[model samples]
Target: MQWNDYRLVLAVARARKLPEAAEALGLTVSTMFRRIERIEELMERPVFHRERGIYTPNEVGDELCRAAEQMEQAAFAAERKVLGSSSLVSGTLIVTSSEVLGAFFLSRHLTDLASYHPGLDVQLHSGNEVLSLAHREADVALRSSRPMDSSLFGRKLSDIHWAVYGDAKSSARLSASSDFRHERFVGFSSSPFADHMSAIQRTVFPDGIVSLSSNSLVLTASSAQKGAGLAVLPMVLGEQWPGLFRLTEPIEQIAGELWIVCHQDMQNNPRVRLAFDALISGIERDRSLFVGDSV
Candidate 1:
């Protein structure tokens, strides 16, 4: 019922151990245990089940945790709206996106924004896994696919075009189509074209023959750079690393759209808004590089 209880549940779910959850929350293990007992006592049922010291959330617990997350997001959104434009805007702006955008794009824009607003602190997260925005895992998110949350704002930023890429040393082995199918392919276990939650992985092998599949675009690019395989990468990424060659024409590459999603609660915060604007502008400036039919 309380935010603290909800937070404790979240931490426990993440850590999967009482001690780990306690440590995460800076509380003693006994205190954590007592909190769980209190929740269970109020509900007249156990929310979590333990097996071999590992805690797993029961259906009720999962539902409560999810509801708690929504409540927290609403609370944060309300707080941000109340602060409005006058707020000093000093807080961690947690941004999440695919590794490619996180590693190559987000940092540069944040750096530029930092010079303008030194008081704002930024945390950028990039990985194949998408963080939960509704849980406040990230204040802002850049995604390759549209967000399903209707309350959250989602906007198409640009189309991401991908091409067969290899380093200059591997150029000799490249010949567009067969070369791509023959060489090792780097891709996520799930892609946009597949049943993955997001589409970042979907375009890796538009031709459909991935010899070597990995969840990491960075790993894919790295493998291509090392001649370990052929990778589909954005033009900007290839340009950033000299000697990486495009094996096919730009029009022949696979492309998908980019989207910017933000929790409604954090939308009005000046810091969050500024970063969102910066991201939009940055993508617009380089729109030509990504491959897709429409922006």
Candidate 2:
């Protein structure tokens, strides 16, 4: 009947363990049991099917759970909306970006922003896959290229250059010559950049001696460091290790247009605005890093 009681049913059904759900809600196990019993009494029907001390949502319970989830989201969104209207530049902002840039660049910038506005909190979704802003999956996107979604808007920050990299010791012998036929490359396992990386591979490693592929940029970097072979890496991330050597100038075909994107509705939200400005300011300050000019 009550919102908090609905939350209890949802939590319990989701977790499937009374103790775990109670622990999450900061309530004792006995209290959780009583609350569930009370909810059943008020509804005049069983919400969960109990078997072997595990709770599974029945048909009636499943419908209630869905409603409870929406209610919870609405409550949180309302709280965020109220905070966004306040003068204080603070609230939770979920940002998505590629692991390499998110970890190497944006993370530092977001940390600085957090330090400046102590109330601001950031949830970073770092990976090779891009999240859709229209789905409310992310508040902002620090990514290469503008979104195709017409409802989204963004500003180009800088150019991200890519280059071939290899181990400092072994790569000393690398050249874009017949010898290239003998070389190996570490490439992306699963990424939107897969086709782009393949294009780079065809140009430099024409022999197609790709030794291994991974989904993680860090692993790719490490592979290059250990002489696994040459790798196409973002200039900013590749230059982090002295043991890795840039084999050539920025690869034009693999170059990326960096942008900060958000939904149209979020354009005027104060917290999102502050965070967006911070990203732009930070990228402008370190523009050279993106273009392989500084490192």
Candidate 3:
């Protein structure tokens, strides 16, 4: 099947419905269906099972989808490599990091990095999910801990410290007491922090009274500032919010090093290298802030 047709099936599998996939690909539903039909006709078999608008990839479809993905990546890599040879550093730099890191740190510096290279496009995806560098999910990643993949190269830029924080009113009311069980707690919905929170529940808040829980640290910090409960937040973020106050010192076990990671193959690519260096320098210059030292 043609690359475009293969992509159509891939999109259908991903979106789980022909109509949605068509919308995403900017094609009419009939056009999308006809394209897939042509693909299946060429293959002499069905690739996907359809039920009530939901499309599930069969074995053949799965294989084709994998091949299609590899082809797409190869095409993109070719384009990137062509740009890499150009003296002018200009291309898309996809950087992934946690919501807290992106919002408080990297996002602010991205504009300046792009301005330094006018042709560069910066896509800063703020989420906790670790995108695979080896798979080319992102050009570079800023993470709390070093990547486990050997194919990746990384630099530890700074230490990220976590501390208990709450609204100023709660701090004023209950700051004297070390036993925080009397106060409501705010915690993450998921992360390596979940285990740290377990320790906290056992040692600090025995009642397990968590008033707010979310995947977004931004929301968690806001909740704490509004007096919802006490939340464990990155010091860089917690300190900047005037409504919030640190309830205790930075936690040690839960703290992790801030790392800038990327695929080893991209080390020589000018845009990737430049963006990577910019990230390291920016974070290095602001290292004290991440470590809870006020600038």
Candidate 4:
């Protein structure tokens, strides 16, 4: 029930090694061992099991760890509320979103917000994986799709469109069939839009070869800029990479909604609220750039 106990448990859960966790927390290995013993004694059960010198959490430990995480988040929220009620917004705000948005859309906005609220310290996590709000992985998330969690509150930022882009030199060689039948394609691995893109590619170039495939948008964009093949990159990416040109004229437009999501409980925290507004306003201001026929 103590914060120190929870910290020890969480650290152990993360490192999966007593010595590593002890070292991270600046505690002796013997002290960590005693703390674990006391925690287990107080709880009246063993939380972890050891096998071949490797320690792993048991079901009880896992459940307790989950509860501990929630408790820690609640405590942090309380501290934020007490500090926030005093006037200005100031604290660490963790925000996450897709890499494309993180790199392009969030770039200038984050810079501006820092200037506007110098007291506020913002942490940005940009990746493809959906960080869980329920698990307190992030304070706010800007994503192309909304999660199914009903406990979270979200609002639409804007609708984003896609385009088939390539280097100008490669674009010049492309033939405009209604379906873009002659263009080569570059695909990202495990794309959320894979099925849709597959159908579009099949409908367009039934026989064209797929020149490059990857999970990295940066790599895909770079390859497209090198005149490797056509890549359906975000308009923002095209703008970021001047060498890249729109290949499919009208740009293979895909209407995907951008959402700002946060746990209902954390939404009211001052730092969290400031970040939410900043994100929404930033996206709205750049709305026009995200849409239209081309970059």
Candidate 5:
């Protein structure tokens, strides 16, 4: 089968649902259905068992998936090598980060980078999901955790401190009592960091009620500002909101480091290297802000 066919099978196997797989490959569900049918016809066997809109890959499908994964890795390595040898500083540079950091802090620095390199195009993808540098999902990333992959390069920017925040009234009310169990909180919904935050809440204040929960830190911070409840937020974000007050000292258990990371293969590319240096310098200049000393 062709590479496209292999990719289609892999996507279907990964997503299980036709619509999601189609979305990942930028194809309509109808198109995906048709393509799969054609693939099955060409192979003279069924690759997937379809039941209630879910696709489960059969043995042949599993074999194809393994081969597809190998092909994908080889292609990515080839692309990385070609890109790494390039000395050109002009091209698209995709930078990924958490929504809060991208909106509140990283955007300005990215704009400055764009201005400095007139030929370079800077794309900022802000989300809670950690994009893979090895997969080339993003060229660089500002992450809460360091890269564990040996194929990637990571630099610790700073330790990002977390603290409880609330509006003036909530802060006053909470301060009146040492018992945190009686208080309410604005917590995170489903996200990469939500489970960790939930664990911290359970351990520190098991009886505290989550009055509001959202995946967006910006929304959680806004809820706290409006007195929805106390929220655990990064100090850089919590301090910037006008109506919010830091209700507690930094919570060491929930604190995490900020990292600037990229695939080792892309590290030597002039554009990637330049962007890395710029981001490192910018983060260094604001180290106090990240570490909660600026407030």
Candidate 6:
């Protein structure tokens, strides 16, 4: 019936739970419930089937949700266009990166950038999930892979090198022999890089044991630091950990490319451009760190 109604239907359909949807929209569960009832009354028909705290959208709701999505996209595009036209290096800039990268590397550069520009507000979102530039979820992204979307512009930073890391004792022991079949390892529980590393490990040391696994590389590295097992970690991270030592040379087969990307429309915005250039320059200065040459 209206934009707000459309949004309510979309949120319900997406969240499937009233409380969750309400939280997303900054509304109380009771208020969300009342609003939905009011919407149905106005429409003179039921839009959702409720059961067991889950809301399933009916046909009428589905149509409204589709329209809501289109409106949302249009609104995002308009916002991007308006922001893109601004030439001043002021306003909020959201940058997303993997937790390890953000904590260990990008944070300093971004901090310096923000300090240099008093008007710039920098927000760093560190997670493994890739935020969508088209949806305006993030302004810039420092990611392990290049951008595949044509609407986004990307610059290749460097090839992220990986190596086997372990505690000093483990490193010494592993270094003494070429045989790794008896070694225990800390491996990733998920991600494409995790799968690739796992395959490499299987091929290289089929009998090696995966003693621990975690979704976060930071956790995997921590496990290795505690002598749980050897870990295959990015060289940048491995070199920085106090107790961990590289047990082997960089693994060429499992190398991942790093890229900094943003929506094409945001490239011209002064703040975005400045932040983008700062990141590129910062990463370039430490290029050896990423590629394992620094070690």
Report, for all candidates in order, the number of backbone clashes: 10, 0, 0, 0, 0, 0
Candidate 4, residues 9-64, lDDT tens digits: the string is: 88888899988999989999999999999999998999889776566889988987
Report the candidate with higher TM-score, 1 versus 4. Answer: 4
Residues 1-295, model 1: lDDT tens digits: 6889998998898899999999989999999999999998988899999999898999988988898778877776665556444467676778998877886778767776666778777888987677877667787899877778886887898777666677776577656554343355555555543344124334444454455665556666777787766666776576465567777655343566788888776677787788889988888766655652221
Candidate 4 wrongly placed segments (more than 4 Å):
10-15, 19-31, 38-46, 58-70, 73-86, 134-136, 175-179, 190-200, 249-253
Work out the TM-score per prediction.
0.74, 0.74, 0.84, 0.80, 0.84, 0.93
Candidate 2 Cα outliers beyond 4 Å, as residue runs: 13-24, 28-31, 50-55, 90-98, 114-141, 144-153, 176-179, 188-206, 249-257, 262-266, 293-295
Off by over 4 Å in 6: 174-179, 190-193
**lDDT, candidate 6, 1-295, per-residue tens:** 7888788889999999998999989999999999999999998999998899999999988888888999999998998999999978888999999888898788768887778889888889998788988888899888888888899988898899888889988877767345677789887777656787788878766888998888878888999999899888888898888899887777777789898898998888887888778878888788777777522
lDDT over C-alpha atoms for residue 118 of model 6: 90
Model 5, span 79-145: residue lDDT tens: 9889988988898999999888888668757788778889899899998687988888899999888
Better of 2 and 6 by lDDT: 6
Minimum summed lDDT over a 10-residue window in model 1 is located at 193-202
RMSD to native, candidate 1? 4.9
Q: In model 5, how large is the Cα lDDT of residue 45?
A: 98
- Give the whole-model CA lDDT for all candidates, comma-separated: 0.72, 0.80, 0.78, 0.76, 0.85, 0.85
Off by over 4 Å in 1: 1-16, 34-51, 54-74, 83-87, 172-213, 251-253, 292-295
lDDT of 3 at 77: 68
Ranking by TM-score: 6, 5, 3, 4, 1, 2
lDDT of 5 at 141: 92
| Model 5 deviation from the true structure expressed as Cα RMSD, one decimal place | 3.1
lDDT over C-alpha atoms for residue 91 of model 2 = 67
TM-score of model 1 relative to the true fold? 0.74
